[model samples]
Target chain A: MTLLNAIDPWLAGPRSAELLFPTLALPVLGLLLAPLLGARWARLLALASLVVGLVLALACTAALVAADAPLVYALGGWAAPLGVELRLDGPAALMLLLTAVLLLLIGLHAAGEFSVRAAGRRATLAFWTLLLGVWAGLDGLFLGRDLFNLYVAIEVLTFSAVPMVCLKGHAAQFQAAFQYLLFALLGSALYLLGAGLMLGVHGTLDIAQIRVALDAVATHPPDIGGDARAATLAAVALMSTGLLAKTALMPLHLWLPPAHGGAPAPASAVLSALVVKGSFFLLFRLWLDLVPDLPQLHVGLLLGGLGVFAILLGNLMALMQARLKLLVAYSTLAQIGYLFLLFPLASGASGGPAATAALIQVVSHALAKASLFLLAGRILVAFGHDRLPALDGFGRAMPATLLVILMAGLALVGLPPSGGYLVKSLYASAAADLGAWWWPPALELGGLLSAAYLARILSIALSPAPASGTGTGAAAGGGHILRAPITGLAAPALLAVCALLLGLLPPALFSVMDVARPGMGSATAVAGVMLSALTPSGFWRSAGPVLTVALVVVLFHSAGESAWGRRIASIGRGVAGFEGWLRQWRTAGALLLLFLLIQVWTSIG
Target chain B: MNEAQLYGVCGAGLVGIGLYGAILGRSTLRRLLAFNLVGSGVFLIFGAIARRGGLAGGAQSDPVPQALVITGLVVAFAATALAVALLIRLATVAHEAASAAATPGSTDDPSTPATASQGRGERGPGHVGAGHS
Candidate 1:
């Protein structure tokens, strides 16, 4: 009886075993039926899946609230190093809940998509399956404890995402998908190299085990042997740099604009909203857990530098885009830059629970960006093109969609009473308290740039003169063809309103942020001088500061004497040549071999 | 060499040969095939690495990497499926365009393109369905 008990732990007849909070089961429910249910069925099924997911995610939050620390679940009673774990800690749980909620919101907004059958039933099937896969993979990524398992989840994410780019199989879309695939492959390879290196020195692929191994190596110098230390640093760089590429950080972001630009509206929302966060989640995990002892000063400065570069380059790229979707894509790239800035702005001497302000910014950014993409997508569908000049009459044509987009754009631009503006204020106050003044300028610049690019649409929205308004009214063809299926558009607008509404109740949002407070709290009152008080007047005066920053950026990136693009042309190639070492024979082959050897050694050692 | 080493060596050779073909091959489809070969090499390398983890000191070679390889195999399949779908669509588009190009002064002829595609699209029996193909 004792021997049998050991072997069949979960096989108990009564199943007295405690049920987990049931996070994994939420997605598993959808996956079970995704193959059988046609796309039409998958829509309601996905909504139901997310609804269950949200309940479980909230339950997890409540559990955390009650437990006051992380709640770890071991599948089938397995513990961490031996068994895979799901840690429904504050941050991950909050993210999961947020992901579920936003997914449900976006899924609602993207309604009738699966029913269109425009690209045929197959396209519809692929879309729902991929969407479910994305949700599952992303959920898996955030919850997964093992590093190697996280890598597999991340790979699944990219595979599911790339096909969405060419769902309709247009020539341009194919090019975009191909580019996305190649870059994603390169990023994966780099991530694997770094992860493999860590495993090599540690002999374990577990996160906690690696952290301890790294800590021990730090104090004891066993795996910290001279060459291994360099390898470790190299690993950190490769991993972060790869993640930066995925995050579309500055120069490595050639693939993002086109990829996001080409995908269908709902798919674009998922891609822009959730997919990138999966990578950033890893970055947060690595910095917090594995490299906890990394010299904070250097790490902070390096991350801060990347953030600044992204801020400058993202806005500059956004400024140059003519197509509306591409413009939104560039704006997305810029928003991502602001996210990287959170590390520098929020971390440092104030690097405690007080840094909850920075974490709040992360949540804010996710919600806001998701809303923005959904808004852009709806506008595209309504107007039949996402070109800048083309959006002129959409406000009249798509009043509700336009109204939602404006609200989302307001949040994106950090306007008053919006989540983005409030999040930025918190981040700004934290930055100021940390004595990092330059970050304020960058934050202000990013906000202003968001306003500028967003204004391209708003300007068109508020345009006094009619823009030809050439197209027949929504119903020239037929009833269904005339008006957009309301569910797809309204759902995102509701999400946009929620993002705006969260700002009104900052205290509630802060409490949610409190759950994920893994770092030490400095106990500083991270609120700032009133944003309203920072101005001479109310809305118009606030616009002045943003407008001034906009002028500076325009002067900075503009052509002719002050042409930054022309000037950079001289140095860009040199930098590219230096960094393009993957083209070299020995370096490329040796790097690959080294990585393979590391993996082999880890399994053996 | 020995069995494990032989497998490892073969995987490495496959990766090298595949990389060579991708670089040299001008044809898009050939390059894609080479890419798949490289993937196979990586899988084989993984198989070789796991060999030591058997009941020997390696203790069945870490279920994590094995699981990773299997997931990777599935993902690779999806990517290949998408790639093939794009290729078939591309060939059709290209062939139609080329046919139009061959018959000069047929720019105004709408049927010129459809007729060219009818021959291929009409005889599309036994073609792989979207996902499976």
Candidate 2:
């Protein structure tokens, strides 16, 4: 059928069927060929699929933006209300294109790190196939208009993702993978329960139909049965809470660090960058698209509160980490916290600038986190360990990698001319506009916390090698230890550049984000507020937090290195203590039930 | 209450019990069983809905929910298989660690804190959080 369509110009022109190129066809083909393909060939095929997927995603984006409406394709030509539909709108296109680009870059990097000839044929094949599977799942998640179909996509994502965590076959890695699997299963079960409840009430699992039904029901005030209202609230709470666990939001994020930290570099990159976003994309669908005016202010606040905790606590944990990969994993947790700001910000102004800021945060974090993890992988390999203290003088050995890290760190710290900066400013302004007077400072504090953690790593990496002849490269005594592969360094460097340069792009680039967008009118006003932050005074106001964080890092470093040891260790213990308490299955379960109860109470009360 | 309503309540009760067991159980296998219990409960609710809703004359139950429940069962089976595989691997790993720890001279490479705590054979309930410690 694809071949036939390819030959027929009229049938082939910008059809919604093109969306499947990345989501289904590529993964299926990858799985089929994985057994026969060698490592090198598998890498090539991955690269090819990613490039083709990127082009297809761009085409869909262009077509959707040009049409200024969602592109909905009915499978077997059975329209919604009967058969499943695939949809590509502004947000879905953006996420799809982002996933393709990240996968392609990560694929290139993985080629260097996971050489088929070096890591055994089976390992290479498994890694590439799993990578492709994650891509396929993410693409489906972005485009899927049906809740049940999205659930299936998430399952594919989880099944593919869990193995990647235990690729090393280490005892610890196995534990992490097992924990990850259990958490995902628990989360998905809850999500399915919600979907089942929705189906029982609405009789259709299609989001579009549910939206229409809810709208029709909303028009009749007294006709709204209390039971239906409670059911909808329970359903929303169940669905989003399930997604929160998968997205690794705080209180539900205990499984993320170990699993993400244990994975191979490319796998970690894919897990951190794209896999988490899959659940988040669905949360977006539920909040912005499906139930925009649900009148669940308390739910929004609860989510925002969790986001705040994730940011602060995630950053604190990242700062406390002695190892590089764990540090990056915790940083991902914090960045996820930043993403949650959208819920509360969106609560105030419908279709406001907050959603756009959240979108920017998603894209920016995806690029930065992928770049950091890849670079961290390179550092891990070059130094033979990822311990923070062991990273001393590594900058001297691999200056290129250090530069990539620095650029990525700057993005993470929300410094100017980086997408993270734009995201922070936009979020701050959104909070200010919401009259939540407290949020702007919290936003600034998060940036400061981010700077403190990033600075901790950069400062350590920049310091001279320890006096003892213990550092990896410096003490090797060989005038020429093997250098990092060009392929490995190049990909992270390129991704870092992309993350750094993203903020410099024209505002017009964001126009595509408006299609099928939830709210209206307030967006332009919010955009104006965000653009004003680019002015000199606005820039200074925003830059103040970054400067303060820099001074704090410097002052902390100036205090005898011995002083930092005790203070940091105490902080570490406190953070770890709380985290340990939360990590217990019993506590996590209790919290999950508590959140559900609170959500149901808020909606009903 | 009608037959479907009774089934729905039964499903809800199963879910509550499963939730408690899954949360409280210490052993991995027990939790896995609890997860299956929850899945069963959810599937039962879906079955009940299908039976109650699809009474357009000749049908016994709605084919859609029936089909979905079947798919759900398949997914749940796959999940169970995966969990069991993990549990087997974990048991082997624990056994190996215990053996390695008993042999004193084998403690040369405490490459990570987690492995070190694992080597001590006293990883206890706090062992899981040692990776980043």
Candidate 3:
């Protein structure tokens, strides 16, 4: 028997093996059933699948916690080296639960967005199928323990997501979808190349087995003239470069703004909130579990450097955007930067503050970004455009949307009483522990930069209204913004509330994150540890400074432009050309190659 | 070099060529074709690895990588079809939009000038819907 089976034989049994059904099978089944049923029924079934999925995910988590070990299932009853294996560990469970919850909210919000009568039967059906398809891929991706299986999951995600981007059937949407497709294909190709090299080096494609083999190789250096080590380094670099491209990290982020900004609101939500996370989740597995010791410091620093660039460049681009959706999409690029910072802070396996902080950032950003996109959709319905200049007094026109959006904005700024604040504090303490003094300052400044853009939009939305409320109530299509149903506002409000309340959730809720923190079972103990980790000094050092900085930014934004402001604004505008150039395919490809070369050189040397 | 090494080098060459073409190609069709080329290269590398006997059973070649390659091929085919369809639709839409803009009066006889103006205002050029880029 394999070491994993010998250690935890019960996990290999059929006890919780059925959980994979709702995750891997049900979404594909829902998609297959979509064509036979009416569009409305298909949507109902899609939402039903999410509900079932969430329950199954929760059950799996409970089972894992109770068992105190990861649950592993060998597909077709054939163990790894012969068949695929599905592993449900702590982080996998958390990601599964996160995907299910967000898909449900996006599904509910999409039900109204893509009506059969309004958007046509075919479009509605396509949206529902793609939604279910994406869920299936994400569920499979999170649970998959085999490298090739994860690759297939990435392909499934890319296929479903590309179509969703072009659901509107617009020329620009098609162009964006096409661009997204090519870039994703490039990413998967590189990923597969790396997986193939690993398979060639080791006889198994299973993550656990590969980890054992890699550790052995590291411990006992084989006298093959260092070729094996070079190959392994190449594999790591190629795989990471591929996943980074798919995740839209900095220079590789060319296709993201166009695609996410071009897709329908619900599609954009799923793409931003979940799809990007799929690749990131795989990279997380690679860094933390598979090759944790190989070129650790250099690779982590390399990724962290890219994260810094993404933060500065993404936020600057967002600040320069004229349209609200593009602005939100750019903000997503910046938020992705925060997720990558975990590489440097959590490079060691101590599993302290940074890891949990990154997880909180992921969950908080998923909810807040989804809510913001939905709110942007409502604004579009109200004004027929989401141009910042034209959106003056929109808050007065749509009070409910504005309030929820403001809450989302607070979360985005990483302000206190929001999960963003929790993430900021956790990350700061972790950075200080690592003696990474520069990150804390960069993190605070990123919060301020993000605040600048959000405040700019909020100021416009809250500007003085025209003489009559009803005058602006009628959109160009005679669609009445005043007639927005309570149900219409319910989803965004729910998401916004969740984002805001994430910080307030019992530290025990973080028990899910403990899945990653193996051997740390006691919820109370975990909570206590997290509490001590969040000393008042840590909190004040990070969240307090960030909050104060954001407040100053908002106030300065409210006070209107000064000479200094104009100069900074001009600097931002100056970078606009660079941003536009980066979006071009040739430049992006050159950067990808450059990044791959750098990573390979550093890892090998 | 051995057979696996030879095939691997060729695969890498294909990938390099495909990436170069995909990046430099301005047209959508050319990029899609380049993507397919990259897929072929990746699959070729998988074949090379399989040929190196990277499986436990001591079979002639690994069946697992072959299985994975099949799936990858299927996914790539689907992607290609979708990309081609999108390119076609984009061309048609652009053509229709150009025609409409070129001779606005000839396309619609029933609508008054005011309705036409309103239609243009609602779904005008450069005014992407719902903030779509």
Residue A427, candidate 3: alpha-carbon lDDT: 73
Q: Residue-wise lDDT of candidate 1 within A1-605, one digit each (tens)?
A: 89757533322322212223356666755766876987667767877888888876766666566566555667878886667777655567667877888788777766565554554677877887787778787888878878777877787788778887777665556656654664565456556546655654555667777767656666766553545555565566656655765666554565676678768777877888788878887877766656554324255555666667677666655654656666667677777776666565545322443245445555666676677677666665555556554344456566777677767777777766666666566666667667777777777777777766665565555443332434432322222224566666666666778766555553443554355454443122323323352355755655677666545644443323545666665464444343233322223334444443443343223
| Candidate 1 runs further than 4 Å off | A1-21, A116-120, A221-229, A295-302, A345-358, A464-489, A520-543, A547-605, B1-85, B93-133
1 against 3, candidate with superior lDDT? 3
Q: How well does candidate 1 reproduce the true complex, by DockQ?
A: 0.11
Tell me how each candidate scores on DockQ against the true complex. 0.11, 0.34, 0.27
lDDT tens string, model 2, A48-99?
A: 8888888777777777766677877777788765677788778788898899
Q: What is the C-alpha local distance difference test score of candidate 2?
A: 0.76
Fnat (0 to 1) per candidate: 0.05, 0.29, 0.40
What lDDT score goes with residue A359 in model 3? Answer: 74
lDDT of 3 at A115: 81
Model 2 TM-score is: 0.92
Q: lDDT per prediction?
A: 0.61, 0.76, 0.76
Expressed as tens digits, the lDDT of each residue in A206-292 for candidate 3 is 888887776677766566536766777788789989999999998788788878886888888899988998898888888777764
Per TM-score, what order, best first? Answer: 2, 3, 1
**Displacement of the residue A85 alpha carbon in candidate 2, Å:** 0.7
